[model samples]
Target: MASAVKVLLIDDASLIRRLLGRVLNQDPLIEVVGEAENGQEGVELARTLQPQVIILDIEMPVMNGMEALPLLKKAAPKARIIMFSTLTESGARATLDALSAGADDYVTKPSNTGSFAATAGQINKQLAPMIKALAASATTYPSIRPHAEPKAAQQTVPDADHSWLTVTSDGAPEIVVVGVSTGGPQALQTFVPALPADLEVPVLIVQHMPAMFTRLLAERLDAQSAVKVGEATNGQVVKPGEVWFAPGGEHMYVTRQGENIVLTTDTAPPVNECRPAVDPLFESAVENFGSRVLGVMLTGMGNDGLAGSRLIKSVDGYVIVQDQASSVVWGMPGMVAKADLADQILPLNEIAPRVVDLLSTPRNRK
Candidate 1:
């Protein structure tokens, strides 16, 4: 028989420890090797148990998940750490901070005490497959290199000679479509907040996330962006200076009504194994807007957006992909680059400015 995946559970509450243990133990592929009621103890147990995975709670006593994460990494560098956080503003902020601090992923805790069955179902549904995939990929070998930057320009517009913002079309884009996953939360935190408040086009976003997490993510982005960011509702109007996120477990598509666009949500089967898949959103944007569309694929895992990018290119629409060096997993954007679908591939830090420049160009107005 195959060996089980060794897991270590860390949390401050006894009830959480018991509940998590019960839930995880139900999986024949997973075996709980150790447990801790605090971050300091969790770190020590992680060092000793050397489990394959660690489910960490951020609100633990003694060290807290953020403070203990680096130490745990040092002690067991190969073990993947998944933070368990509450579904609140503070929890969202802390979870993002944990990711920046090197946690692999996160899951939300159950809101009510009696919701163990539902929470366990969600956890198993979301994480088990991801963990299995990560385990399989962990054995692969590849060394990554640092990205080379273009030489500085003499004028205010840096690298103007090699700038990727050239307009190839003769009209204003009719739609703006964005794709993101994996380390998208951090990327969005940096890029979306920088967009101009008076942006004159409708924007649609597809970010890979679970249902409850998307709501929290939308709330966080709305708090930061000049644009009104919110979870996409069925049949909502897509307007200027407002950004709509594809709700988890549903695909978001665009349809036109006169000169305006209407956002639609559907429960169609998962595409590319993701419900709010980037491909559907991208393809829908192409169908609805044709040559007057801008497709941007950001940092993410897997090849979810490449096919859609090709569709956009076939219609003479513009495509921009995040460069590999700035990506967390480099799967989605790398696929676009490898397929030669991207008009330009840029670093994460440069993407927002590049977008602004693209939109603000005189040629963009046709």
Candidate 2:
């Protein structure tokens, strides 16, 4: 018989430990080998159990998940860690920190405890496939080496004289659309916080994640950015100096009504194997905003945004892709570059400034 996947659950709450343990134990393929109520204890248990997976809670009293992650990885390099975080702004920031520190995946702690009985069912449906895939891929794929910080590129804009000051009626873009996955949290942390506070356009983002993660991501972004960032709600008017992110398990698209653009969400068929896929957002931009859209594809693990970039190009919308050397996985943006869908391929460090420069230019009129 095949050996079961051993799991270690670590959280401060006894209720959560019992609940998650009950839920995870239901899976014939997964066995809960151990449990820890704090990060320090979790680290010790991890060394002892040598589990195939560790479910780590971000907020712990003894040692936080972020701090424990590297130590845990050092102790058991082969163990896959799945961070469990609350659906809050602080929780999102901590979760992203854990990911950067080496957590393999994450899940949100459900707010409704009454729904605890169904937790395992939901987690298995969403995470089991990813875990299995990671396990299978690990045998063939070498572990990721730490990537160096990317150096910024210095490229002179064509219309350098007019780049900073020119804002013509024809060149003023109304919306900025962004798409990312995989290494997005880190990328977003670097990108979104750097955007100019006085930016004249509204930004729409679709980061491939679960529903709970997206909400937390938006809240975290909102706290970090001068511009308002929040989960996209149906019929909400798109406004400048604000950002609306695609909700998880749903597709977000833009629609124009009179002079205003409104955000809409739906249970649309999954595109590119993601409900909040980048293709629909880009496709919708082409149909709704036409030449006024600026589409950006960033670091991710798949070609989810490639077709979308092509669609943006079809309608004369400007498309920018993050260069392969700067991407964590180079799957999404690399696809756009390979297909020649991008107007320019830039490093992550240069992408935001280039965007600001492009939108600031008068010659690239809509």
Candidate 3:
């Protein structure tokens, strides 16, 4: 049998630490190796224990999680770190900051911890799978290569594995729709900035996050990117040279109003357990743009985009995905790849350049 995943918990609250420890230990695949009350202690214990995963709280005295993050990384370079954050505005902002600062992922603390059993159940359900995924990926997965310049400016054909995808788009892409989760913030930080400012097609992204985090992410990415980036709003006109993220807690779609394609949002029931699911956006894109869709699937934890990718391909729309070696969790793109839906499978750094290449290609406009 595989050895249990080793985990270290760091939080200021004694009750939280106790509850987390109890719940995590109950999982047969997990073993709680240590606990710390603050980042300083966490860092020290990280050095000694070298646990596979570290769960660090954002708000703590005597060295907050953010302050100790780099230190913990330095002390235990191989360990994957998951931040524990609140579900408030500050928590959302801090979680985004942590993700950009190299934290693998995060889980929000329960707002009402009034019932020990309920809180513990939430922790177990939310945290254990995350811990296992992160730890397994860290120990068994290859190290992520630093983002670098695209190797070639010219468009490249799909690899032999994708030779079955003989059909190609008949027209230059009119819109780019991206579906990402888990490691999305970090991936988008590498991707969005690389897109040229004069891109002729608007880009729509669905990154699984809460409402505040999605808005904050758009704002943050816009600050760094040459192209305009913001959260998608109802009735906004979709135009070239801008990037829009689906706001958390809502599914964003596109509709044709007269001659203009406009963005739309709805509170429809969650698909695939996600409010801003990729399927709805992809399906809507196909409906609005027909064969002019370009679907890009980045690193994420589940197969949310698989169905959408299928829709894109059925109409000869192009679909590309982040390759396994470059993914934080290969589940999303892996599913599409396995199903032969991707026209191209690329690393995070190359996705932007490839999109630009595909968009620039001279194809018949139908």
Candidate 4:
């Protein structure tokens, strides 16, 4: 039998603790080994118990999640820390700060206390799966490679595996579409900075995040990157040298407007259970750029990009995916690779260069 994953719940609210415990204990694979009402106690328990995972609340008494994050890591290096944050502007900022401080991933707490059953369902549907996956990664440490270049990629990576996909067609890539989740914040921290300042292709990204979180993520990435980055606005012109992000709670797409490519956003129904799904952006790229789109599927859960990549492949558009070793959860990329659709399977470090290399390939299609 698979051993239960030991989890420590650290939240300031007793109600939240009790509710979360109720939801988590129901899962046979997860065992709530301990509980703490503040960060200081959480840190102490972490050092002593050394559980496989920690669901850390960002806002807590005695010591908030952000302040206690580094210290907790020092105490329990092996425990994967998942931040619990409210769906607010300040909460989003704290969540990003926690990620910078080395927290593994984050999950949004219930918006309000008005709904219990629905909130519990969210915990079950979202938080439980996240805990299970993180614990699995902790048990199976091979998902992280210790020797990867650039500091951010050194954690949670597998052995390097790649293949340069080839296609026989004449197409000029005008834009790059990126999709990532799970380890996305850290992954983008490195990958975006690696991109050349004079990058010719306009980059659009969809990172599974909430409304304010996407804006904060863009700001963080832009601060470190040579290429300018920002949240995508409705009907903005898609130009070179800047990376645009699909704002959370909306779907972003691009259309050719005479001499310019115009970007647009919509609150369309969630696709593949995600507000800003990769398929729509990838499909939009096909509509405007045809076989010249470069679709990149990064570390994320589920198969959001499979259908999009299939469409891209059918039109001879190139698709590059993050290798398993470099992914926190290789679900998105793995799905495309399983279908034999990816043209290049690369580590995070190699993806930007490969994009630059492909951009330099002269269009000679007949």
Candidate 5:
């Protein structure tokens, strides 16, 4: 049998540590190796234990998760860190910050359901699978991807090797739709900024996250990216040179109103077990733009975007996915690739330039 995944729990609350330890230990595939009450202790224990996974809490005395993050990385470079955050606004902001700062993923603390069993259930549901997934990739993929260069230095010039760009039977894309989860925040940081500021088509994105996190993600991307980025609003008009993300806990789709395409969000039932799932966003983009849509699937878990990719290809719309080498988790992109749905499977860094190339080409729009 395979060895159990080693896990370390770090939180200020003794209850949280105890709960995590007990819950995680119940799994024969996971072993709780150590526990710490603060970031300082966590760092020390991480260095000594060299656990495969570290569950870190954001708010703690002596050393908060943010403060200890870099130190933990330095101490145990191979371990994947998952942040423990609350479900509130501040927690959401801090979780985004942690993801950007090199944490692999995060799980929000259970809300005040006033039942210990419910809290434990929530933790097991959210954290256990994530721990296994992250640990599985720990030795294979780096905890943090290497930082990419600015847009000017990293431009992809097409050559004979780039023959895959001719697959689009549809006209040039009128709109770009992206579906990503898992390591999406970091991947977006690499992909979005590379887009030209004067892009002629608007970009729509669906990143699986909670309510406040999606808004914060939009704000952070907006601050760094040349293109305008904002969270999608129900009646917001979609325009070129701007990017909008689907609001969390809502399914965002596009609707054409006379001469304009507007983004619409609804509290519709979750698809693929995710509220802001990629499939809905991709399907909506195809509905509004027809064969003029470009579907880009970045690194994420699950096959949420598979059905949408199929629809995009049925109409000869182009679909590209981030290759496995550049993906933190290959589940989503892999599914599309395995089913032979993607037109091209490019690395994360190459996707932006390919997108630009496809958009710039003329199409036989009838």
Candidate 6:
């Protein structure tokens, strides 16, 4: 028989522990090997059990997640730790810090739904898939990816011998649209700040995140980047050299009105099960800029950008994707590459510089 995924649960509340156990036990392949009520106990449990996955809550007694994260990492270096955080500004900031400190990902803790049974269902809804995906990834070592994938951990660009659809295509780019999720916070920290301040086009992004977290991410990026970064506001005039992120839980779209392009946000139904989805934004860019748009798909889970990328390709708009080795989850970019929709597949470090070089190429204007 296959070995079950050993899990360690760490949260202050006894109720949460019991509820987590209820759902986790439902999965035949997952076994909750240990439970702890505080960071101090959690660290002890991790050192002893050496679980495959750790579900850690941010706020706790005897030591908070912030204090225990580094220690837990030290105790079990190979474990995939998923932080449980409240959906608030401070929580968002702390969660980002956890990610930087090597936490794999996080879950926004849901509010009480009156009864323990109802809340258990809610928790399972969010936690089940996340834990399963992480476990599967952990079981297969990073180096053991499929033959079609490039070195997933490598940071270098793929060889030039590969057939790429674009070196520099005809018209100068009028806009850049980015779709990223999962490892986006860290990836953006490195990538966005590297772009030139005097870039000739506006850049818009859709990052799958919550409300307070999106704003905090924008603020953090703005502080580090040469180009100003801000969360997209409805009816704002999309200006050159600025970076605008779609506010979480809303759908942001771009449209040309007269001589100026503008952004609009709405509470529309989600695409690919994400509110701030990549498809709507990419489709809008295709409608507005056509061949003058650059679509970038970065590290994320699921095939959120595949349709959008296909639409972009149909319009002669160029696309670039983060290669498998450097991605947190290669789902988005992998789909694009397999579909032959991407013009360039670059590592994280090479993407920004390539953008500048691509735009620098001479264009023939009508």
Please provide, for model 3 over 1-366, each residue's C-alpha lDDT reduced to its tens digit, 9 standing for 90 to 100.
889999999999998888888889998999999999999999999999999999999999999999999999999999989999998999999998999899988988876677888987788767898888777764343433322221111122332122223344466789999999888899999999999899999999999988899999999999999999999999889789999999999999987789887999989999997889999999888777777888999988878988888877766787888988788888788778777677777889989998898789735211
Per-residue lDDT of model 5, residues 196-315, tens digit only: 899989999999898989889999989898999999999999888999999989999987899898999999999998898988888777666766888999988778998888777755
Better of 2 and 5 by lDDT: 5
RMSD score of candidate 6 (Å):
6.7
Superposition error at 254 for model 3 (Å): 1.6
Overall lDDT per candidate, in order of appearance: 0.77, 0.75, 0.85, 0.82, 0.83, 0.81
Candidate number with greatest lDDT = 3
lDDT of 6 by residue, 153-258 (tens): 1111233221223322467888899999877887888789989998888999999998878889899899999999999889989788899999989999999999
lDDT accuracy of residue 55 in candidate 6? 92
**TM-score: model 5 vs. ground truth:** 0.89
Please identify model 3 stretches exceeding 4 Å from their true place: 138-168, 362-366
lDDT of 6 at 264: 97
- What TM-scores do the predictions have? 0.73, 0.67, 0.89, 0.88, 0.89, 0.87
Number of clashes in every candidate structure? Answer: 1, 0, 0, 7, 0, 1
lDDT string for model 2 (170-237, tens) is 44566889999866877887788778888788889999986767887788778898878899988989
Candidate 1 ranges beyond 4 A from true positions: 1-37, 45-54, 59-63, 70-80, 85-97, 100-102, 108-125, 128-169, 362-366
Instruction: Please give the distance, in angstroms, between residue 242's alpha carbon in candidate 1 and its true position after superposition.
Output: 2.0
Candidate 3 lDDT for residue 120: 79
Runs of candidate 2 exceeding 4 Å displacement: 1-64, 73-81, 85-104, 108-172, 362-366
RMSD in Å for model 2: 8.8
Candidate 1 residue lDDT tens string, 1-366:
767788889898888888778877888887889999888998899999898888889987788999899999988888878888887768877887787678777777876657887868766776665554344335432443222321111122222122322223456676789999877887888888887898878778899876766777888889988989999999999788888899977999998888768999999999998989998888778677766788888877788988788777766677788876666667788777776667777788777776666666725422
Which candidate should be chosen as best, given TM-score against the real structure?
Answer: 3
Error (Å) of candidate 1 at residue 73 is 5.3
Model 1's TM-score against the true structure: 0.73
Between candidates 1 and 6, the one scoring higher on lDDT is 6
